[model samples]
Target: MSHLLRAEYGPRGRSAGASTWHVVRAADPATALCGRTMDTDAETRAEEEWGTGLRCCQQCGSLYMHEVPHMEGSHPYS
Candidate 1:
């Protein structure tokens, strides 16, 4: 049960509102345990657990998420 998450990246002095939204694939709740106290919400937990490795954009110093495309062969209709 992977989940979708939003990660942000922007200039140092900029507010979160000025940041860009990146849609990321997050681990399922059953797999995201870092031995720390859990957040009240799932989104925050996913961000904290998996957001560390996201790379910043070189051109704009912004971070973005990559969405995994659905493979046609995996779909029953295909």
Candidate 2:
């Protein structure tokens, strides 16, 4: 698996705050690993893993969890 990048895109529905984070690539900025396209220029990127509260792309989440692992003592849950 390749290195995973987490980014947030907004306006999911009626609420402007309704944004979903997804796994994307540095090469393909507009496309998520789950195959959704968003305006990459407007997206806010997460440091490493995605934020906790924002919803995640199911497919991308599954793929990301497997691709990028939390090193021992690195994450809160670890």
Go through the candidates in order and give each one's C-alpha lDDT. Answer: 0.34, 0.63
**Residue pairs that clash (backbone atoms under 3 angstroms), model 2:** none
Tell me how far the alpha carbon of residue 42 in candidate 2 is from the true structure, in angstroms, after superposition.
2.5
How do the predictions measure up, each by TM-score?
0.26, 0.59
Query: Which parts of model 1 are misplaced by more than 4 Å?
Result: 12-18, 28-77
In the order shown, the candidates' Cα RMSDs to the true structure are: 9.9, 5.3
Instruction: Tell me the tens digit of each residue's lDDT in model 2 across 41-64.
Output: 554555365646567778887866
Leading candidate by TM-score: 2
Cα lDDT, model 1, residue 63: 30
Model 1 has an lDDT value of: 0.34
Best by lDDT: 2
- Per model, state how many residue pairs clash: 0, 0
